[model samples]
Target: MSAGVESLLALLVSRGGGQYGYEPVSQLAHALQTASLAEAAGEGAPLVAAALLHDLGHLVEGSEVERLARGEDDHHELRALRLLKREFGAAVVEPVRLHVQAKRYLCAREPDYLAALSAASRASLAVQGGAMSADEAAAFIRLPQAEAALRLRRYDDCAKNPLAQSPDAGHFLPHLRQAQAETRTAATRPDSPSAQTGATS
Candidate 1:
């Protein structure tokens, strides 16, 4: 892993200090599941890594900072994306920025999407201004990466720890490492189209 991702992993380990909310699940477990699901769904390594570390800004900045950022309506995606961009490059940042909007877009465009959302997502959707209008959703669908964004959303939704279907946290480490390594390779490749597209195309 790159020094940055290694540092991120360490931060996640420490921040998982304990469980919040209602279950025995650790924050680390949640992150692992997110990565695993993204990988399984055929997301590129950067996207899987992005999925895994999407909430790291909250861990690093703490709830108070997060609250302040959110009070300004600033999304966590940007904070995380900025860090990833600085450390990795555009390849890792674009997907992170798009993930949140992917959720919003999916909820607006897909008839059954909202029903699959976790309680947290459902609540956040309201704070995110909920579904988009038909015209807005139609316009969003025209974006080149919209399909990838939708796939990411699908994996994200399935990543939740359903009462009967949660997987072990350790099962995800190998995939996370693999994805991280792939991201590092892709980011450093001189010929990568992502480099030309600023990673968003």
Candidate 2:
């Protein structure tokens, strides 16, 4: 794997806290579950990895209040995306930014969507401006990565399984290593040749 991707993946696997409230299902575990679900649902490696690594900013930045009080930014998604962009480029960062918006949009547009949300999500929805008007949601839908963002949001919801999902966390380290290797390989491919040759025969 490329050194950058490898390093980033290592950081993510090691740094992630467990899911928001439950100690048994860590952030890393949640990420692994999300990635696995995305893969099963036919997402590509990058998207799967994106799912796995999306919340990593929380680890680096700490909780929102702590970060803001410290005079640093509190938005974990932005911090995580900034770090990833420096390493993996925009393909990884775009979805990370949009996932939060997707959640808000879903809450606004899909009447039934809120019913499926976890308690934490439900509580945060209003704080996140959940009462946004239809016009606000429509504005969000116009973003370029809206669909992929929605897909990631769906995977995020499915990642929560306090009992069944806990076991899978054990397997995440190896998968993270493999993903790092894959990222490295993709980064170093012969882009110049492909760009110059047009379509390879």
List runs of model 1 lying over 4 Å from the truth: 18-24, 62-74, 162-201
In angstroms, give how far residue 45 of model 2 lies from its true place: 1.8
Q: Tens digit of lDDT per residue, candidate 1, span 62-142?
A: 452345336333466666654565355444555666677888888887768888776656766766667888887888778
Off by over 4 Å in 2: 17-19, 22-24, 64-74, 165-201
Q: For each candidate, give its TM-score against the true structure.
A: 0.70, 0.74
Instruction: Score residue 196 of candidate 1 by CA lDDT.
Output: 64
Q: Relative to the unseen true structure, what is the C-alpha lDDT of residue 25 in candidate 2, on a scale of 0 to 100?
A: 67
Q: Rate the local accuracy (lDDT) of all candidates.
A: 0.62, 0.66
| Lowest-sum lDDT 10-residue window in model 2 | 181-190
How do the residues 1-201 of candidate 2 rate in per-residue lDDT, one tens digit apiece? 345566666776677654553334667777777888877898866677678778777777667444333544345667776556544434456778877778888887787888988876675565555645888788877877778788999998878775644334434445444544444333433354542454221
Predicted model with the maximum TM-score: 2
